[model samples]
Target chain A: MDKTQNNKAWFLVLPVLVIVAFSAVIPLMTVVNYSVNDTFGENEFFWNGLGWFEDMIASDRMHSALGRQVLFSAIILAIEVPLGIFIALHMPKKGFWASFCLVLMALPLLIPFNVVGTIWQIFGRVDIGLLGHGLASIGVDYNYTNDALDAWITIIVMDVWHWTSLVALLCYAGLQSIPQAYYQAARIDQASRWSVFRFIELPKMSGVLLIAVLLRFMDSFMIYTEPFVVTGGGPGNSTTFLSIDLVKMAVGQFDLGPAAAFSIMYFLVILLVSWVFYTVMTTLDNAETK
Target chain B: MMRARSSAIVMTVYLLFLLIPIYWLINMSLKTNTEITSTFTLIPATLTFANYVTILTDPSWYMGYVNSLIYVVLNTLISITVALPAAYAFSRYSFMGDKHLFFWLLTNRMSPPAVFALPFFQLYSSVGLFDTHIAVALAHCLFNVPLAVWILEGFMRGVPKEIDETAYIDGYGFGRFFVRIFMPLIASGIGVAAFFCFMFSWVELLLSRTLTSVYAKSIASTMTRTVSASGMDWGVLAAAGVLTIIPGALVIYFVRNYIAKGFALGRV
Candidate 1:
């Protein structure tokens, strides 16, 4: 649809602009202000120039947190995308069971982040928790609180349990949109199940798959509350990701200049990914409209 | 028939994996702390509603839910009310910097709540809105409004421009036409946007926790108090966690009918 030129249309947009500016722009500017300046108690300040950014860039702690964050995100994508696709393929196509599956699967997603953390924290406890107690009983040594590998695994599994449904749900919707005619054509050809999934479903799901990947990646990158509640960044900072580290610096230690500098860099990374997401989504929207 | 059976088996195993942890949570919520620590039972040996009783009877505990609901509802209302017009503008009209505006709006959605937490504390504090329900509601608008706009725009774009032209030729003014005609057409879109808004606001802990303290402390914050009081109060903690899941569960249940449809058309 061709849109008319309308300068007056800004009126419709102005409310969003004002609300976002107050909430987004102003706080963002504050972060910038802190990133470039030094401050002491009673709001004393001095010019810091690029010093904080320079420090954060060279900081090994920052590098390690970023490394862990990237690896976590990679692992999440690796597990969730395939698992979600598999689950979607096996899901009941239509009927009471489909509705039942959808409702049950969506339950974890709606729960608050901290509650999710709490659930896992209790569920993974060595003394009382089912997973930990069961593992112990089986002679499999595991303690999420003390072991770094266990902590990592626990967080990863917790994330998978919390979020895989989102991926499956998106792909299910994509699958639903495929006409029965396509399946009938495949049947006439006697296409093997693998071939049907590969040729028909895979290509069809590409659009929503990208959407699933982007959402999962962006969200997994920003994970904080769940991990925080579970491990409190762990036995020895073993589970501390970027957000956890930033919160420790900014709020826990009150290192405003460095934390703010770290935030800018952190945001820049998400912004870059989100820009790609925006471009792809806009292109998809345009294709549909045309 | 064999293939369908295998698929059913696969989904059954997967669903079991999902439900066990939740079941474990419910099981813990129903057991006493002594039972939780002393024994590992698949089912609670002695079912008790003591934890639920403790939370429901405690003002501090139950008010956390109330505070969360108030702000979530407020934020959703504000986000949708503002986003509706903005979405209409972006979906239907070509204007100066509209593309730039849209992209900028999305950046906020992607912005980490951790990044905004400190500055929002300062901003809200300076305005003297600190620790108030309204502050959390306004602070949450940072992400929710942008998301609402994006979702609403997607739904609005599907509405043909012919509807507008027909309404205009019928001598309906823009306001009446928009309110009476355009809105009804995109009502599902509005519902979808509102649902997304509510979900994000409800799940978010960082911003809401930061923007409010006592008098308006959210359930998530209130839950944290259990961690600090002497030893862990496992039963009440589990109960609070279970209660927190209730509202979200109820919300999802109500929207269960439209959830798939909502997601198919909604943006992240």
Candidate 2:
């Protein structure tokens, strides 16, 4: 696993760098440029400096959207990680059943985000949708379109349904990587089931668990299309998250300066968290190697 | 005995929960538009394929699928092709700023696509690549290339250095060894990476929708426009949704085994 010191590796990486720079760096520069300028209709512009950033920071709407985004991400990570681990543990180790379960479970993940929203939207409709009609028949008031709490629950459940398989699959792979000898040793020691899970399985799954949490968190925080399709940010602004709000600003209203500033801040938060996760992942990798 | 029984129950219930909504969509797709809106029926009382017929017959509807496939395949191909060399370098060699570079690439994956939507629109427009398949394909590489590199690097690191050394001793050049021996060794990795690229590109709407208009509009955007314009044609919408799920289902069927490992190994 020890890598040789070879600067010539740059030649190999050059293609990726060129491609990513074209796609990422150029657009990113444009966002930065827009963040500092004020513009009128005919491409007229003036320097806005920190005005947009200041306004974004002071706005109550921004605060609420950030609050909702954080809560959503936290809830997603908390639920999906443990639930995924549980599902993975229960899954058949090997058989036709394992393959069947995997393929079926992965189906939700492959569906388009908007379609996922559309499916849930139709499935939760009061008139013709199954869930809504069933709930109504049972004398429960459940309308995602009209009620804020209903909207929140629908979005959360929809997300859990869509993404839990990802976590389970990752955990299942982690579990599979554990050598049979480890389980044999645990059995020889007469380890209890809880102890076996605690000592042997939990530690082994930590790496994949971290990856699952990071991915789930980032994706949930940036979620837009599904919720947009489901409620269009809802009867009010209750379901509007950061990305939804930002899209309204940047694309809908053309408030370029504020949106660009908001975007930079949004990008920074993800960058910061990912950097932390990266550091932890590397540390874990090194520990495993050692 | 008790534990095994409980595990089976748990998995059965979980699978049912996952399938019900998809089942609902399919059920809706099978029913006529009038049946879909007027009544609450678990099964289609009168089955119809008119929605599918409409999509297949109409250029606007079916071309959405074609446009999506073109860009998605193009993006996947470009991402994996470029990422292979970068992943090889990261896995095997210690280059300048390698760690920083890797982290930076990953940050793009973490970026909210909403942020890039506007700038990408203007960037592609200025270059006159707007509404073109290549524009969307290239735009997607921002995230897909980084992901492909990360996945491929994990798989590549698992291959021992001895293989490369032996190949060299046998008079195999770098390119030859890579194509013949190294690539075959990591074929599953490549498959997993390509699947991930395709899945992300296929599912993403913001960047693709932003970068392309009429000629290259994806099915996802097309579906959205349908909802907005026609006051919700539930049956046809369900049919389009069902069709969109087909390609992904096919992909998952082919790569089900690798998918778990792909997630566990990539960036972990």
Candidate 3:
């Protein structure tokens, strides 16, 4: 896989670079510009320096949103990874059943994020929705619109339902790549099922597992639409994560300066975490190959 | 035998849990609004296609679907076309800043769409591309191009360098070899990349909604407006939601096997 030295490769990458730069760099610069300047109506501006950053640092609102976001992502990763792995392990490896399982499991993933939110929103309603009415009929009180705990549970479950299939599919693919000779060797050694999983399967699946973790972490952290539709970050600001809060500040209220600063910091955190994941994964890949 | 039986039972339960909500949505879509609200029936008391009729017959409703498809298709085509060469470069030759460039592309993929929402709104409007299909398609490239490169690079790397050498020995130029030989070899990779691009573009709302208002309004945003306006038409909303799932379902059906292979190999 070692590549040759060819500076002309730059030409190959130019088209992507131009498109991404237009889409990413220009807007990013605007955010930076807004972060440093205060503006009133008619696009009139004043120097704000680090005022917005200072205010963001001192604000409890941003802190709470960050806290909620971290907790949500952690919970999602903890649940989805193991549950998805379990589902993948149990899945039929070949034939019609495998295709059937894949198609059905992948359905949630293909649905629009807002539709997912709407489905859960109605499904969890007390009067008309099935889950809500069923819970009430069974003498269990549940209302996502009112109770913070119920709202949190519903969002978590909704996320799990929507995304667990992705993890399962990735792991299933990882499992499929293992050669049959490996299993034959384990059988010849009379290896226990646990040992077989521990020795043969886990290491083989690590590459895909890392990819799954990274993807799930990034996506869950940036989640906006589904939760926005379902809870509107509501029942009190309890469900308002970083993205929701940022949108409220930037678009809803037009606090451009603070929102810009907040966004820079938010983007940095994701970048740092993703960089760390990327480094670790690449290191593992290199080590495995060596 | 016992273990296999338990595995089957567990999978059955898991599948049911996955399916019930989708089933509920479909059930609601088939029922009239009155039936949907008044009764707790597992099956529709009386099936009605009025909701579907409403969507199909209305320009505002059905155009949302058309708008989404146009941009998604455009974005996928542009992303893959641009990414193929970039991916080839990364796979075959390590140029100056190659590693840094690769990582930087990924950082864009990691960048939160919310951060860029306001700036993109202004940027597009200033250029007079706002509310246009091309604007959304271009804006989505920030993420999709990097991803397409990442996925395509993985597939390209899997193809031995010897092919390029052999093609050269056969006096085939880079363009000819790429189109005639390399493309067919990595066709599945392209399919997988296109599928991922389409999925992300299809599901994304905030940016697409922010960037386009009328001429290129997406179905997701249209659904949101429906929920907010006056009395909520639960039946129609459910029906709209059901329709939104159709395109993605069709895509998944076609690429079921490639999807898993793509994920496992493509650094997704």
Candidate 4:
């Protein structure tokens, strides 16, 4: 759709601009101010230049948290993407069962992050919770509070429970968009089941798959509340992802300069990665059109 | 036949896996604390609504839900009111920096809430809006507005431009056309946008919790801070959790049809 030139359209957009300036821009400026300056009590401040950034860049804490964050995001994508596709593939194509499956699968995505944390917290308790009690009765000796591996598994599983529906739902929508004629053509050609998935469904799903992966990556990278409530980033900083670390630094310890520097860097990394996904998505769109 | 059977089995297993934890939460919510801690009954030995009773009767507890609803409603109304015109502008006209503005708006959606927590805290506090429902609503606009714009733009694009021209030729003014003619055409889009706004605002806790301490505390925060002298109040906590899930579940039921379309950012 070709849009006509209309500078007057800015009037229509002015309201959004005002709200955004207050909501996003002003607060962002504050973050930048805190990053370069040192603050003392009574609103005293001094120029520290790029010293905080240098310190944060050299810090082992940031490195480990980044490492853990990367690993966590990688693990989440690995498990959820494939599993979501599998679930979407098997979902009934339409009618009663399809609606039932969709409504149920979407349940987790709608729950509050903290409630999601609390659900798993209660569900994984060893005393009376079914999962923990069931496992203990079976003699698996599982405890998320005391063990690193258990905490990791619990967070990962909780995330999968909380979010895989999103990917599945997106893929399901993508699958729904495929014309029936394509599938009938494949059947007429006597295509193998694997070929049907690879040559037909896979190509169709690529657009949404990238979206699923990007959303999953961004959300997983910024994850804080669920894991915070479940493990409080504990069993000794084992589940402490980037957001957890930043919150602890800025709010918990009041290390404003470092936290501010960290925030800028954190925002940049997400921006950079998102830019990559955006570029790739546009390239694909262009190729598709061509 | 074999493939059909296999798919059914796989779906059954996966569905069970997705549902069991929720089932467990439900199961715990119906039991007494004594039974919750001491007994291992799959079914509640004696069903109880005492936990739900506790949350409903307690002012401190239920107010959290009210505060959450207030801000969420405010955020949705504000997001849609502003996003409608902006979405229309972007979809219908090419203005200077329109593409850059759209891209910039989206970048905010991807910006981590963790990054803005403290600055938002300061920004709200300085303006004397801290601990107020409006504070959180405005703060949430950072992400929700972009999404509403993106989703609404997609919906608006699907409506042909000839409608606008037809309305103009009929002597319908811009305001009248937009309100009476254009809005009804995209009423479903508005619902979808409002639903997304409500969802993101409701589910978000970091900025909401940070901005409000007591006067306008969120239910999720109330649930998190739920500690009795004895220790964790598992029964009441689970009930609060269940209550939070109910609103979302109801909303999902209403929007089940548009949900996939909305998730695709209004693309069909």
Name the best candidate (by DockQ).
Answer: 2
Of candidates 2 and 1, the better by TM-score = 2
Q: What would the per-residue lDDT of candidate 2 be over residues B1-268, giving only the tens digit for each residue?
A: 9998998999999999999999999999999988887877889998899999999999999999999999999999999999999999999999899999999999999999999999999999999999999999999998999999999999998899999999999999999999999999999999999999999999999888888779999999999999999997999999999999999999999998888998775543
Give candidates' CA RMSD values in order. 1.4, 1.0, 1.1, 1.4
What is the full ranking by lDDT, best candidate first? 2, 3, 4, 1
Candidate 1: CAPRI quality band: medium
Model 4 clash pairs?
A: none
**Runs with alpha carbons beyond 4 Å of true place in candidate 2:** B266-268
Q: How high is the CA lDDT of each candidate model?
A: 0.90, 0.93, 0.93, 0.91
User: lDDT (0-100) at residue A33 of candidate 4?
Assistant: 95
TM-score of model 2 (CA atoms): 0.99
Off by over 4 Å in 3: B265-268
**For model 4, how does the per-residue alpha-carbon lDDT over A123-143 read when each residue is reduced to its tens digit?**
898886778878998999899
Tell how far residue A160 is off in model 2, in angstroms: 0.3
The global Cα lDDT (0 to 1) of model 4 is 0.91
Of 1 and 4, the candidate ahead on lDDT is 4
The regions of model 4 sitting more than 4 angstroms off are: A286-290, B228-230
lDDT of 4 by residue, B3-69 (tens): 8899999889988988898888888899999988887888899999999999999999999999999
Residues B1-268 of candidate 1 have per-residue lDDT tens digits of 9989999999999999999888889999899999988878888899899999999999999999999999999999999999999999988999999999999998998888999999999999999999999999999999889888987887887788999999999999999998999999988888878988999999999988888879999998888866877588888988888888787777777777667656655532
